[model samples]
Target: MNLNTFIQKKINKQLIFPFIILAIVSGIFFMSIGFRTTITTSKIELEKAVEKWNNTFTNMENFLEFLSYDNNLIDNTEKLGEILKNFYNKFQNKISYIYFSTSSKNILIYPETDMINGINPNTRPWFINASKNKEKTQITEPYVDHITKDIIITISKYVNGMNISGVIGIDINPSFLNDILSNKDLLLISKNNIILFSENKNKIGKTFNIPTKSERFISKNILLITKEAKGNVYIVTYKNLFLELLPYYFISLVSIFLILFLGKIVNKNINTELKNSIAMPLETLVNEAKNYLNNQTFDSSKITSNIKEIEVLINEIADMISIIEANFQELKATNEELLDAYNEIEKYSGELESTYELFIEKMSNIVEGFDENTGNHIKRVQILSEFLAKKLGLPKTLVRQIYLYSPLHDIGKIKVPPEILTKPGPLSEKEWKIMKNHTIWGAEILDGDPRLEIAKKIALYHHEKYNGKGYPFGLKGELIPIEAQIVNIVDVYDALRSKRPYKKALSHEKAMEIILKGDNRTSPNDFNPKILEIFKKYEEEIKILWDNLNDNK
Candidate 1:
C-alpha cells in the first residue's frame, strides 16, 4: 500500500509476469490443437461418406450390367418384376422402390401403388435418358423424389433383347449414407443447394444457403466442411467454433489459474529465503559496523546468515577492524619515537647549515683580499642574487643554494697574485691573463663538493660571456650553467656599482643604463637575455638591495 511495500513487491511482480506469458502461450497452443482436431476429424468423416456414396453409385451400375446379361430375366416383364421384387426386399433400407420398365408402357413398381398408373415407361426420365445411350446406362443426379419427398437417384440400363426391347431402371433412396459416422453429424446436399440427406431429419428438405465460391466455407453461422459425391456435396457443419473448443478453453482457464497460484507461492518463498539468507544479515552488518565505528564495540557473531559469502564478508570486516585497531596502538608509539628522532635531526641540520654559511662568508672575505669595501661588495651581490632568484620563481631549495653560494663566485681570486687584486691601475696584458685564471682556480677550489656544486659552476663559468668571448673556456650563451649566468650578471652589476680601485662606483641608474645599453667595457650581449630581462624588470628592487646593503649600512 505504501512506497516501501510497493517497492518490496516489485521483484515479485517482475517474476510473476512470465507466468502470465506462459499461460497465454499454453492457451494458444491448446486452442490450436482443438481447432485442428475438430476440423480435421470432421473433414475425414465427410471424405469417408463421399467415398461410400461414389461406391454406391458404382455398385448400382454394375448390378444393372449383370442383369442385362440375362436376356430372358429382363425381356419378360413378369419375370423382371419377380427379379426386381427380390432386390427390393434385400435393399429395402436404401431402396424405396424397385421397378423394371420397357418401352411398351408396361411398368411394374414393387409395392405397387395407384401412382404407377401415371408413371409411363416410354416417357419416364430413366427410360427417355437411357434408351438412346444404349451402351452406357445413364444415372440421374441426386434429387428429391416429388411424391415421397426422399432424396433419390435413378439408374437405368437399355436392354435390346429379342423379346424385350426397353430400359431396366432402379430408383434408389441414398439417405442411408448418413450412417457412416456415428458421432459426427453429416448431410448429403444436392448440387442445387438442397439438403438431400441429414441426420437432423428437419434439415433434409431445407435449401442449403451455400456461399458463392467455396466447397468448404462458413455459411449461415456454420463452418461447412464438404466433399463432392456423385454431383452432390457431403457436408459436416460446425455451428459454433467456441462451443466446439469448449473443452480446451476450460482446460486453458484451469491451467492459467494454476500458473497464477504457483507464481504467488514462488514469490512468497523467494521473499522468505531472501529475508533469512541475506536481508537480516545485511541489516546486522550495518548495525554492527555503526556500533564499531561509533563506540569501539564489535560483535560479529550478531550477524547471522545461511549464505557462506555473507558470513565470510562479515568475518573479513571484523578481522580488518581488529587489525587496524591493534596497528593503531603500535602506530601511536612508533610515531612518537619518529617525532623525537626528527627533532634531533632537524636541530643538527640547522647547526650544519649555519656552519656552511660561515665557511662561505669566510671564503668570500678572503677572496676580497681583506678589503672592507670589496667585502661589502660581495655581501651585496649575495643579497641581490637572493632577491632576484625569488622574483624569478625559482624553487626554495634552488633559491637558498643561489643565495648561499653566490658570494663564492670570486673565491678563485684567492689564487690570484695580490698585485692584480688591488692594482689601482690597468693591468698589463700578462697580469690580465693571470687575472682570468681566477675563474679556473675558483672552479678547482670549489670542485668535487656537491654542496657547493652551484658555487663551482659560478666560479668556473661566471666570466664566460653570452657571446662566448669573455671566458677561460669560451663557453657560449646557454652552454654556461644557469646559476653561473645568474652570478655573472650579479658580479657585473656590483663591480659597476662598487667604488673599485680603477673607478668610482656608478649610480644605480648609470649602472642600469650601462648594462642595458653597453658601455665600452661591458655589453648587453655578454649576459643571458632571460636574466637581463629580470634585472631590467626589477631594477627598482635591485636598487633597494644595493642601498640597504651598501658599505655605509
Candidate 2:
C-alpha cells in the first residue's frame, strides 16, 4: 500500500483505541486532581487569612496602649486635647480624630469638642462589639467610614479597666494590608476555586489557565498539602507555588509511551506486508490451476501483471492442468466401455426375475385347471389374502410378500403321483396321510435360496392350523406366524370354492360361515378366528375378486 493508505489503516486500527483510552483516563485524572487541589488551596488560604486578621488586631491593640498610658498624655479632657493636637501636627494629613465617652449616657464627652476632637461613639459597630464581649481592645470588620469614604478597620479599648471607658479608634486604609499580601504572591480564590482576585487584579475572577505541561503543578500541591496537615489546624509554607515543574516531567513520560506504542504498530505492519508478498504468488498460481482443470480458458497476457513470480507460477499450473484434461478424455472413453458391460448384466438379471414370474403363473393355471369348477383358484386366493391382510391392518410388506408367494402353495403337488392328484373318489386314510406331506415337500423345494427365504416361509406354513391341528408339524396358536395364519384362511376359502374331483365348490356364504363358526378361537382350530372375521366383512369384495380371476383365466 501507499504511505497514506498504510498510515490511514494504522490510525484506524491502532490510534482510535488508545486515543479514546487516553481521553477518558486523562479527563478523570485531571478532574480528580482539580477538585482536590481547589479544596486544599482554599483551606490554606482561609487559614492564612484568619491568622493575618488576628495578628493585625493585636498590633493595633498595642498601639492603643501607648496613647492611653505610655505617653502619659490623654488622662482626662485637657490632656486628651493636647495629645490630639500634637498627634495632628506629627502625623500631618493622614491623622483624623480621637474620642472619649461615658459608660452609658452620651451627655458628657471627653475634651468636650464637636467636629475636630471627641464626638458621639454610640452609633459605631465597634462600640457595640467591645461592650458585649468586654474586650480590652478590639477591631471590627472592614467597613466604609462616613467621612473618609474609605474601607478601614476600627480598634477600641475599655476605659478605667471597667464598663465606662472612652474609645480610642483609628481607621487603617485597606490598601496597606492589600499591598503587604500581594508581595507574598498569595492567590485569592473564590469558593469554587476559580481565581477570584490575584496579585494581578486585571485577571480577577477568571479561570486559572495552566498549560497542559503545567497541569501536574496543581496535582502535586494537593498531595503535598494533604500530607502535611497534622490535625484540623496546620501550616505549610508556599509548597503549591513551587510545584510547577511536575507537568513538564509528565509530558516527557507521555512522549516515551507514544514512541514505543507507534514503533510496535509500524513493525507489525511491515512484517505483515513482507509475509503477504511471499505468499500471494503461490495463491494466484493455485487459483489459475483450479480454473484450467475445470476446462476454463483464459488469456496468458491477462496473467502478466507486475508480479513476475506469480505470472510464471500461473503459467506452469495452467500447463499442468491442460495435461490433466487430456488424460481425462482417455479416462472418459474407458468409463463408457465399462458402463455398456454393466447395462448388459442388468438386462439379464431382469429377464431372470420375469422368467420366475412366468413359471409361477403357468403352474398356477395348471393347478387351478385340475379343479375345473373354480377357475384360477390360486390367483383368487392371492387377491383375497391381500384384501383381508389389508383390512386387518397387517404391515404392507408382509401382505405383499404373502400375496406374491401364495400361488406356490400347490407347487409340491408336482411330486404327487397323477393318479392320487386326480382321484375321483375320497382319499383313503393312508393316501390322505401321504397327501399331507406335500406341505413338507413344498418347504423342501424352497429351502436354501437366500432371496426367496421370506416367501418360502409363507409357502411351507400356509397349511398350518392356528389350533395346531391342520399341519405336518401341528404348530399351535402364535407359534404359527401371522403370515401363515393369513394364507391358511385364504387357502381354505379357495379350496371350498373350487370344484374338486372329490367335492363340489361351496357358495361364498357357506364357505364364510364355515371359516367364522364356533370354537375357531380354541386350540386345533383350522384357521384364525380374527382373520376369518376380517374375511367375512369383505365377503362381497372377495367374491368379486374370485369371479374376476375366473373370468381372466
Q: How would you encode candidate 2's per-residue C-alpha lDDT over 142-199 as one tens digit per residue?
A: 4555555554545565444222255666544345445424333444332233442344
Backbone clashes in model 2, listed as residue pairs: 159-165, 196-205, 467-524
What TM-score does model 1 achieve against the real structure?
0.45
Compared with the true structure, all predictions reach lDDT values of 0.77, 0.59
Q: What are the per-model C-alpha RMSD values against the true structure?
A: 35.2, 33.8
Assess the local accuracy of residue 80 in candidate 1 as a C-alpha lDDT between 0 and 100.
74
Residue 475 deviation, candidate 1, in Å? Answer: 99
lDDT of 1 by residue, 189-245 (tens): 656676655666667667777652265676444666766665334444444676778
Model 2 Cα displacement at 161 (Å)? 99
252, model 2: CA deviation in Å?
93
The prediction achieving the highest TM-score against the true structure is 1
